[model samples]
Target: MTSTIRPSSVFLVSGGAKGITRECVIRIAQRHQCKFILLGRSAIVESEPDWAKDCFEESGLKKHIMEHLLSQGEKPTPMCVQKVFKKISSSREINNTLSRIKQAGGRAEYVSVDVTDALAVKEKVAPAVKRLGSITGVIHGAGNLADKLIEKKTEQDFETVYAAKVKGLENTLSYVDLNYLEYLVLFSSTAGFYGNIGQTDYAIANEILNKSAHLVKQKYPDCHVVAINWGPWESGMVSPELKKAFQERNIGIIPMEVGAQMLVNELDAANHTTAQVVVASPATPPARELDSKLRTYRIHRQLKLEDNPFFMDHVIAGYPVLPATCAMSWIINTCENLYPGYRLFSCTNFKVLKGIIFNEDLADEYILDLQEDSKNNDFNEITFSAKIWHKNLAKKNQYNFSGEFKLLREISPAPTYDFAKTPDGNKINENREVLIPNWEDNNFYQNGVGMLFHGLSFQGVKRFLTFGKERFTAECCWQGIEAKQQGQFPVQWFNPYAVDLSTHPLGIWLQHFYQESALPAQLDKYEQFARIPCNKDFYVSGKIKSKTDINLIVDFVIHDLEGKVFVRLFGSKFVRWFY
Candidate 1:
C-alpha cells in the first residue's frame, strides 16, 4: 500500500532528543512542516550555563572538569561525568535540534519521561495528543546495551537492558490507538538476529521488538509496522575499540547519514509488507590473515551468582564457582563457531589451573588464547592448546584453565558393555547399619559441601557408597532439564551437565577426608570413549590416589547402567581454597 505524510501529521519519536532519532527528525522536518513530539529521559534546561557552553566549544574542558573534581577529593565516576556534561551539553544539543526543526518550517516539542514507566508515558502522550491532534506515526528508537556474557549478567543488568526496548514499546503501545495509527517503526539491532559473543541480554531485548513488530502488523494490517535490524553505525553508541573489533570480523559500520536515509526510505516504502528487514553494509575479507601459530579472543563479562538461580546450586565452601564441565562446554562451543562442520571429540591433558569464583559486585573479564600445532599435517583434524585467563584490571591476568582439545568431523558409535552387571568391589549396602539411609541425611555433604545445593536436578546425587575416605561411588540420574533448557538442535554426546553430575563423587571425597570443600583445580587427562545420552542413569566411581596438605589427587570413571564406560578422568586434582 502506498502512503504519504501530510504537512500537518503528528509524529511521535521516542529517544528523539539525540542520536539517530534526532537526525531522523531533522531530515523529516526538512521535507514537511509536521508537528513532532520528542520523548526522552533527560530534562531540558531553561538556558545553557557559561561553563557548559565553554565545555561544548572548548577541547580541554572535560579534562579540566575531571581534574577539578579529583582535586576536591571526589571520585569522577560515570554518573558524575554524565552529570557534569548534561548540565550544559545535553541542553544545548536538544535546543539546537529543536531550533533547526523550527527553521525548516516544522513545529516540535520535547517531553521528559522514562519510557519504561507506563503511567508516565501515558501522562506525557495524552497532553501531546490533545495539543497536536491524534498521533499518526511513531518511531520507537529507545534502547540500551549492557554487553556481558550470559554467565556474567546480573538480574539488574538484564532488567535495565530489556526495559529500554521491550517494556518501552509495551508502555507506548498501550497509549497509542493502533486502529488509526499510520506507521509504527522500531529500531532493532543485528545482535538479536545473529547472537553476539557478549550481548546476551541486549539480543534478547531486540529480538522481542522484531517479534512484536510482526504480531502488531497482523492486527493492524493498514498500519506500517516495520522493525529494522541495523548493523553498527557511526554514532556515539559505537566505541573505537568496538569499531575495530567489528572491522576485524569484516563487518562494515553504516554511516550516520546512510542509516538515517535508510530509515526514511523504509517508511516511504510503506507497503505493509516485510515486517522485519536487515540493513547492513556488505561484508569483506580481513585485511590480513590471522597467524596460524597463535590466535586470541578477549571477552568482558560480569558474572552474578543470582542472575541464573540454578547456578547457585553449584556452590563450594560458601562460594559459587563455575563447574569444569560448563567451562569445557564454553570452549567447545567457541571452537564450533570458529570451525564449521566440526565438533569437539575429546580433550586430552585437560586441566583447571584455577577456580573462577563469582563476586557479588564485580564481574570478571576473560581471554581465550589458542595455540595451533605447527607440526600436524592433517587438514581435517585440528589439535590446539587452549588457555582461559581471567583479566584482572589492577593486577596481572590470573590463569583459570588450560587443556589440549581435538576436533573431529564426525564421532564413532558407542561400544557396547553393561556396567550394572559389574561386581561392586567397595559397595556400601543401603540397608547396612553403619551407612546412612538417605544420602541427604549424611552431614558430610549437607554441612561440609557447599556446592551441592538442593533442587538442582542435574547435580543431584541419588545414592552414595563410601568405602572409607580412600574411595567412593555415587549414582546420579539425568533429569533431562538441561537439554530442554539448552534447546540444542542435535543432542551432543557427553552432555556438559551430565559430566558435572558424574564428577560429584570427587567433591564428596574432598569433604569427607579434609573436612573442607574443594574445587577441581587440575585434570591431568580426560578421555571420552563415547557420547552418553542425557536420558540415562549413570554411575560415578572415584579412587583417591594421594593426598597432601592442600591437594588431593583422584581418578574417576563414569559409566552408564549398561556397564559402558563413557568417560574416564585420571590424575584429577582438587585444591582447597584457604580463603
Candidate 2:
C-alpha cells in the first residue's frame, strides 16, 4: 500500500464548486492544504450587481430582481426569475468555496467550462495545468438527473443525463498525465448498483463510471483508484417528496458531513488493490426478481486441474477422475442460480455414464443443458432435467452425466429415521450375522495394497463397524481437509466429500470379497433431510438388495447415533470397469 495524498498534491476536480462535491473539496483542503483546479458549468462574476445586492434574504432578492425587470419594460415570469436566481446563487457559492479554501490554507482556481464539451474542457484544462504545474489526482463528481420512466423518456433526456457523468470524465482524463497521477476517485450512485425506478438513464451513466474505474486500475496497478457507489444523501438532488418516499420504503439517507469526510479519508488512505466500492445505506431493497418461467438453458465451462485443485487429491489408478458428487453439485448450483427464490430439495436418476479422466487431456471443455419439466410442476414444486455433455476425440457429442432436480419455495421439515425399516421401503432383519472388518492399521485408503486409492483430502473413513455380503454399516468422520486452502471446492450447499465417503463401504466390500474394483454407475434418487455436519461422526448403513454378474443394486441411509436421518440414497447401482 502507498499513501494517496500529500500537502503538495494537486487535484483536478469536476463539479467541485457546489452541493455534495463542494463539501468533499472543503474537507480535502482542510486536511492536506492541497491545490485544486475546480471545473463547473456555471459562470462566475467577481462581484454581485448593485440592483439585487441590498436584499440579503432569498425571497427579498427574488422580489428585487422581479421589480428591476419590470422597470425595464420586461415581463417578469416565474421561470425568468428562477433562471436569474440560479445564476446569481451559483456564482456566490463558487466565490464562497474559494474563500473558504484559502482560509483553510489551500489554493484553488475556478474554471468555468461545460465538461460535456470536449474541446472546451481541453482548452480550459490545458491552460490551468500550465499555470498550476503537473496534475497528481482527479475526483469526478459531475452528473445530471432527468427522471422519467423508460416509456416516457426521449433520446435527448438520456443524452443529457449520460453526457454529464460519462463524457465529462472522458474529456477530463484526456488532459491528466497518468505517470504523475496517484489516485482517481469516481463518484457513482447506488441506482446503478441496484436499479431504481425512473432513473434508467442516470443508472446507465453511473454504471459506466463504475466499470471505467476497473479498466483504469487494470492499466495502472500502482494507483489508488476507486468508484464509490454512494446512496441518497440528506441534501444534493434529494427533493422533499423523494426523501419522504425513501423513508417510507425504509431506505436510509447518508448525512452530508459523514459522506464528505469519507471522501477525504479515502484520498489519504493507503490501499490500491480495491477498484470499486459501495458507500450506500444497508436498508436498500434487493434487485428485481428474475423470470421464473420454465425454459431450457445451456451453460459452457472449461475444465482443468489448475481451476479445480480438489481433483488433484481425487485420483484413481494414477489419473484424476471427476467425483460423481461434484457433477451433482454443478447441476444443483446452476439450477439454484437460475431461479432466485427456489431451493433444490432432491435429485432423481442421477447417472454417471462416463467419468471425466484428467490423464492425457481427455477433455478440456463441457456444456450443461437443463430443461424444465413443466408437466410435473404442481403445488409449489418445480422439476428440471439436466445433462453434462462433451465431445470425444472423434468430434462426436457424448454425455457424461444426467439427473433430475426438484426445487421448492420452502424446504420441508427434517425427516426422522425408523429403526424398523430400511431406506428402500424394506423391513430390517436385525438378527442376521454380519462381519466386522478390522481397519485399526488405517490402510483402507492407502495405495497398492489398500482397498481404495483416494489421496489425503478424499480419505475420510475413520473406521468401519460391520461388513457382510448382503449388508454393511460404518462410522465415518470428515478427514478435516483445509478446503479454503484448496480454493473453490469447499462444502457449500451440500457436503460432497462426506457423501463420497459414504459410498466407500460398497467399494471396500466388492474388493474384499469378489476381487473386483467398483465404481458408482447410477443413482435412482437422493434426498437431503438436513445438512450433514462435517466435524462430527455419522453412521452409514448399506443394504445390497440384489447382485448380478455385472452390477449390484444397493440402498443407503445416513444418520446420527440417535437415528436422526440426514440423507437417503435409494436404488444406487455400482458396476465393474468391464460393464
The candidate that achieves the highest lDDT relative to the unseen native structure:
2
Cα lDDT computed for each candidate against the true fold: 0.71, 0.80
Give the alpha carbon lDDT tens digit for every residue of 1-579 in model 2.
464567678889999989899889999999989889999999997678898675668898899889988988999999999998888888988999999999998888999999999999988888877877678989998989989889999999999999999999999888887766888899899888887879999999999999999999999888889999998888888899888877755578889999989887777666558788888754333223334667999988887778677787787777888889888888887876676446677899999988889877477688999999852334456789999989888889989999999876556777766442222212223443233343325456654333366666666665455565677676778756665534544565567778888887677777666767667899999988777777788888888888888888899988886778888899998876532
Task: Encode model 1's per-residue lDDT on 241-333: one tens digit a residue.
Answer: 889978866578888888888787887774658899988743322323223554555444445555444456665556666767767766776
RMSD per model, one decimal? 20.4, 10.4
TM-score of each predicted structure versus truth: 0.50, 0.55
Residue 206 of candidate 1: its Cα lDDT?
92
TM-score of 1: 0.50
Task: Tell me the deviation in Å of residue 278 in model 1.
Answer: 0.3
Best by TM-score: 2
Q: Which residue runs of candidate 1 sit more than 4 Å off their true CA positions?
A: 51-55, 58-82, 281-579
**How many collisions per candidate?**
7, 0
